[model samples]
Target: MGTATPHGARAHARAQHGTRTPTMPVVPATDWPAPPAGAGPLVWAETVAGGGYAHKVLARGTELRLTDLHGDACAHLVLLAAGRPWERFNAADTVKVQWNAYLRAGHLLLSAQGRVLATLVADTTDGRHDTLCGTSTLVLNTERYGDGATHCATPAGRELLTLAALKNGLDTRDLPPSVSFFQGVHVDANDGTLHFTGSAGPGGSVTLRAEQDLVVLLANVPHPLDPRPSYTSTALEVLAWRAEPTRPGDPLWDATPEGRRAFLNTAELLTCRGQS
Candidate 1:
């Protein structure tokens, strides 16, 4: 199953909506129970810094937490609805739904259909990160490392798209117009061409609270700042952790005001070294 590029996909979506901006509703971020231990299966694996491969998967009602085991690390992320392939991610909708431009702790990941796909339950940075950019693949041959290298393919932007398409039973021919992490965007000569600026460096982790079944793909490539030929650059390491759904009446399940307070108290106690 080959899919269209992000740019093409967006264009198609626009055509369907008559170029009108999609509507999204703001929702409060309420505390929800975490997932049980080991509920999510590891679909793909990669490490940060070592620069090997990227990770991709389709998750439903899952809580994905990308921890910067080491600070100053940046992970590129892309999300799409499992049910609707053509209806992809809309950053504007997400911002509108959250009632804020920046996503941080206590925000939700909104889908193009005006649904809450995930929630930002907790974040260290208070959600002051970039959402305009997405992730992509890398090819080694076309990079600055020189042609005819030891390996056939290195990391590049387009490869990630191909991998995602393959995993989703789609072909890689029609890649989507993807945003980059920590990449800068600007217009040139009245022509809209989003460019990458630089790396979305260390300790920068983003977590999404899955509202429904969704497929997410991630990669690490050069930023707009690099401006060199594309290549298949791998990550040093990549780790995927799912916060399994907690048991009924679990502290994390508290959604009401009173429940939230109680949950926080319980969480604090659990964090204490000598709590029973």
Candidate 2:
């Protein structure tokens, strides 16, 4: 008979040692062209209170144009890496990359790893948007609104964190600290707090050119405005070019002549609709 292996010895050895495993698959970054000067028209609009909600995932190289159909609209924006949860937008990093306090056209939105996620191609105002406003959230109890039974809704910074995690296959538990937009900063006893601000002037707008595929989210919360006409849209369109073009440098950055025309046409359409 063949020599019988010592079963107890083999079992003990197996328990004492483990086999090596292969590493996880590495995902490569996606390459995409930037948004052209004249890309498209309005997508959609929803009327929201001072504190409402909006969110979207922008693929690599997709341009997002935000228009303040009416004046004093506040938009809170956040950025994240396509697949890495830990690699998200850091305000400190963005500020250092741009070498300025506020973000404006021609600025690059840098990720924690120093990667270019999006580029600020155009803006109606000087590059001075507030980054410390924070997000809105749902409130369980509030004396100003009503009794404990009544619930109030508001935007919150946590929403962006949740979306970042969801996209990266990570749980919301791992969301990092986030920044805010369209808000003002206040200091009380040296502790910083974000206060609600008004919207930009009517017809004011800003547009971002994506360097790579990006996911974006936006929202509108209830503020001091009539619930009706809180949000309205003129038009939304997408224009694609056959080839990638050079970045348009600074000055005259508002959309190429063609883009301006498309925007104006959309605005007129909206005006006509309102009249009807």
Candidate 3:
């Protein structure tokens, strides 16, 4: 199926409310089990250099971690089912159907096929992120930041994802839409323009738990609306480990009425493939 809306638009019409701090009661986060303490051994890890990109395949029970090593990092992440790239993430459906504009912990990033790709199972930053105002584009960056500014557009992320999927014999055209982590953006209530309100501090982090085998692509770049004088983008640390299976009363599956239904859809999809 085609995208319900261009991810480039980042759902321009959607209004959002987010938190500057996790302490804000208005942006409550779900309870996640305490991660095993210490910087233990990881299955795989890398530091994505500023302006660089990377991609990987995360199994259904793998955890992907993004860390803001320099206190100011933006990671544009795109995801698609490893076995079905056409069934990619749908930002509009994720926002409208799930009744949420801002995503934090306990939220499922839904796909156009009504399947859950991953769950925002953990966030230790400001508890805010954007599925709207996708990564900067070549045309956009050149227009605003001048020539060569096109260096870090979101497609850079697609390129990485394509590279990662190459082992699977997939190409760039198979890449899909993405969500920006650490980009705490919000829509102006009165004017409806997107605002880059800033993001995570040093050591801050967010985690995505794969709901199915996923082709993950990412880049460390400036948010489209970032006001920093320079690109200011820096290296980001990507870490992975096995994720525990969800059980009865799991918060993400039970976060909302839509979440439950989405989880069911994910289960049915997996079951049909005999993965369940």
Candidate 4:
């Protein structure tokens, strides 16, 4: 007698048999590139499809890397303090405190409380990340594309992030302004006009080390200002591994007095909370 197969299982078996190509399984890659010296084993690794969302809670000493696989993905990110959800990323502080509008290696991402959230430890995108412009919204994306809802093929960045927030036990109210990597914006110094510079080319990557425990939300979508008429974006590679957090004597910690103060603030909070 033949063994009985459940209805769902029988359907799945038939579909698999008829399929020419199968999607990759969601499993950790056994062969990722080496991490920095003294770094721990990889903790997270995944590929985010275009117009997709991803979120993760990283420890204080971990490093997260985002790569533009095909030179068209805009990795929009929003960071919140894992221990204290109210303390989220402050873009104004990140730029004003550093006295620089552009982000690069050694730059610190600051929070509203004047504490450091993450540090830009490595960047290959030539400091072409945007600090002025945020992610795309459902309304704008809907106007550009036929549909911008989360259930559609071309979900807006805001909608994707909203989903990420909800998955992490938060709500829409927790959403904050985000920063975009790989694609950049240029401000006309003469007239204060913002210009979209497009992508930084393929294989560009940026790595950020967590200064505090963080809940990071990422959306890989087309930049709102992208000149391309169509809603198109390529795949994005997300990799994270354990790494040593910045210390007082680290070059990045002392890169600038303002940055140093921010790191000190972060350390004090972590130490007081016994998270250090």
Predicted structure with the largest TM-score when compared to the true one: 4
How do the residues 1-276 of candidate 2 rate in per-residue lDDT, one tens digit apiece?
222568866775676454321221111111112333554432322333334334445554556665554454455566665544455566776676455556667666656666555666667744325654344333421222332221234233344335434654655554443443333333344654434334344655566655444455443332312133322222111122222211334342233443333234423433564621
Alpha-carbon runs more than 4 Å astray in model 4 = 1-6, 10-39
Residue 271 in model 1: lDDT: 48
For residues 174-196, write the lDDT of model 3, one tens digit per residue. 65556888868888999989888
TM-score ranking from best candidate downward? 4, 3, 2, 1
Query: Per-residue lDDT for 102-188 in model 4, tens only?
Result: 998999888899999999999999987898788998898889887899979889999999999999998888887898999999999
Residue 273, candidate 4: Cα error in Å is 0.9
Please list the C-alpha lDDT of all candidates, in the order they appear.
0.46, 0.44, 0.71, 0.86
Which model is ahead, 2 or 3, in terms of TM-score? 3
lDDT of 2 at 256: 44
Clashes of 3: 0
> Judged by lDDT against the true structure, how good is candidate 2?
0.44
lDDT by residue for model 1 (128-224), tens: 3556554433333344544322223444445655565676776554344453433334434377555443434445555555544566655444442
Q: How close is candidate 1 to the true structure, as a TM-score?
A: 0.52
- TM-scores, all candidates, are 0.52, 0.53, 0.78, 0.90
lDDT against true structure, model 1: 0.46
